[model samples]
Target: MSTTPDRRILIAEAALDLIAREGLRALTHRAVDRDLDLPAGSSSYYFRSRGALLDAAVRRLAQNSRDAFTRSGLEAPERTDDVDASARAVATTLDEMLLRRRRDLLVRYALAVDPTIDPELHALLATGLFSRDAATTLMAAHRSTQPATAAADFVGLVEGLVADRLIGARSRDGIRAGTADSVEQLARSIAVFLRGLPTESTGTRPI
Candidate 1:
């Protein structure tokens, strides 16, 4: 690496890629160095310890997630008045996430499950809120009587679907093959939930 700040960021990103594809066992200084075609000891030189390297990867993942959501126009709702539109918009974002950001998601789950082994992983996941606030806001705009609860439910629904698909895809049979259709089904389910909710004038906004 060039020893610039950008180099550190790039190294961190490579660490994320390593974890995303090959699990945490693959995230070593030498592995990252080799993956990025850098000189031996380059990764350890930049991030002195394994914990430091993991922290950097978490930060990079957070930034990448924010950028992805912003680019997909899911950070904010476009047509708040139309519940169906919001559902489709949110569904589109979920689809993009599963299709393009699967690696990040895998890394996230690994960190979540390995927190006991690496306590820093817990703090790292805590710092990165996972866009829950945005989901709440979008649900609120759709006029949910309990936007916070509804948003939580909707987000949980999508998460379950993605997790299942990811697991199934890696199985021997590869039984789950339809990403677009899954996202559409999720969107339709969310729309149905939103449309069923009775509109209310006042409610506590999600924090």
Candidate 2:
């Protein structure tokens, strides 16, 4: 199938949508073509096998994750002096991800639980493009001597909270109020967690 760069991205995004809404079983080349209203063999032309298509979709979602972080102004903070400000930035970023980019997060979470996607997911996370790496970088920016350890702890905390919310652990209110409350709670938790960290190798000055 003759394809352009744009069409490949579109097909990958369609795969993500299918997985997010209909489940991974529904992520077929034909299903993607049908969803996109493309020619019969279009998706197959670009991705000959199911694994190939899934890989493409996973990569696309990774790129989307990076884009979202950048858009939320959490890509990289210039200073680590103000932990509260940093925490708020992180909370705002999570609010954006949970509210505006929920579908992408769902796709990521779905892939996380799928053993078939484990290799691909591991590769993606290792690339410094997703959460673990992002969190590591964030900690390093704050001059944590053991950035990896801190990042792991912080990411685990946040991911657990998010997964709990996503899996119907709590009832959600209307979007605005829910998002605000979630962000506030995240910010507070993040600040508190950071404060609990050892201060020896951290650049985070005491407030």
lDDT of 1 by residue, 38-82 (tens): 899998988999878988998888888788877977776653667
Which predicted model would earn the best TM-score? 2
**CA lDDT, every model vs. true structure:** 0.73, 0.76
Question: lDDT score, residue 87, model 2?
Answer: 86
Q: Mind sharing the TM-score for model 2? A: 0.84
Clashing pairs in 1: none
Tell me how far the alpha carbon of residue 108 in candidate 2 is from the true structure, in angstroms, after superposition.
Answer: 1.7
Off by over 4 Å in 1: 1-3, 115-120, 126-129, 168-182, 202-207
**lDDT of model 2, residue 179:** 64
Q: Worst lDDT window (10 residues) for model 2?
A: 169-178
Can you give the TM-score per candidate against the true fold? 0.81, 0.84
Cα RMSD for candidate 1?
4.3
Per-residue lDDT of candidate 2, residues 38-131 (tens digit): 9899999889999889888888988987777678766665637578888888877776667777787787777776777667565783442347
